[model samples]
Target: MSHEQIQSCIEECLRCVQACNHCFDACLQEEHVAMMRECIRLDRECADLCAFAAQAMSLNSSYAKELCRLCADVCEACGNECKKHEHDHCQRCAEACFICAMACRAVAA
Candidate 1:
């Protein structure tokens, strides 16, 4: 992949990680926390995957493409879960996850 593409992917992954964490924390504070259980779980998964993907990309790992594919899947899942909620944090996180997923997919392609 080109340097610009790698850099863009990394940036998007980092942003996704941040958004996931923020959304996860905010979900915990909601009145309907019980309903947000799946979203919280996915938020953590998405954040961890994004972080790993970014690290692999930064190191130019041979498996970076595979990792990014997994990351994109997790990001899409997280975004879908977040979209089920009406909270501001969830909305923001969903947007970030979608952006990250697209970026990762581009890099993998």
Candidate 2:
């Protein structure tokens, strides 16, 4: 049902937020911190968007779909950035972002 779908999307968004947070922390600990500047920024952005999307969905807000759309965009961007890195945390974050983007799209649809 619609409610279930929204709940699923919220769960995915939360997972993405966790992954992004992990990736951001891992990136900061990388040897070449300067090289991960963009990755860190995108990770932060994606985490924030995912959290917002989850909150909006939980409240059944009028703008939930709009937030989901933005969340998907940020997730995709973060995934792409994480994909460029070789770290295991980055790889995991990328997968989470991709999955969350799909879940968000389902909600927006």
Candidate 3:
């Protein structure tokens, strides 16, 4: 893939990482934190994966595509979990996750 294409994916991954982290923190502060356990867990997982994917892409690693594929799956799961919540942070995180998933898919393909 061209550097530009990889750059776009990297940007998306970074954005997702920020969104997931923010949501994870916000979820912890929710009135019913227990109810947001899944979302919080997924947010952490997704953020970590996205960060890894971004770093791999930055290094132009041979496994970047593979990592991106995994990242896409994690992003999708996180997005779905976030969508279940009514909080603004959750909604924003969901949108970021979905967008990042698409970007990851494109890079993987």
Candidate 4:
């Protein structure tokens, strides 16, 4: 990928990371937060993977594609977990994860 393309991907991954963090915070404010421990965990995992993917992309690393693919997988799983809840934050997080997963999948090697 060109520098611009890599930068764009990194930007998107950063956005995903932010969204996941927001969602996790929102989850904590819910009355059913105890039931959302796994969801929160997944959100954090996805965010970390996204950051890793962004780093790989930024460096033009040989593992970029593999990291992107892993990021997509984790984002999808996080999305599914978030979707199980009906809160507005969960809904928005799920959408963000979905978008990030699609983008990562499209560019993954």
Candidates in order, TM-scores: namely 0.98, 0.97, 0.98, 0.89
Single out the weakest 10-residue window by summed lDDT for candidate 1. Answer: 64-73
Residue 2's lDDT in candidate 1:
92
lDDT of 1 by residue, 37-87 (tens): 999999999999999999999998999999998899999999999998999
Candidate 4 stretches greater than 4 Å from native:
1-5
Q: Which residue runs of candidate 3 sit more than 4 Å off their true CA positions?
A: none
Q: Model 1 clash pairs?
A: none
lDDT of 4 by residue, 13-102 (tens): 888899899988888888888999988999889888998898888787998988888899999999999998888878888888988887
Let me know the TM-score candidate 3 reaches against the reference structure.
Answer: 0.98
Point out where model 2 deviates above 4 Å: none
Model 3 agreement with the true structure over 1-109: per-residue lDDT tens digits:
7788899999999999999999999999999999999998999999999999999999989999999999999999999999989999999999999999999999999
- The lDDT values for all models are 0.96, 0.94, 0.96, 0.85
Better of 3 and 4 by TM-score: 3
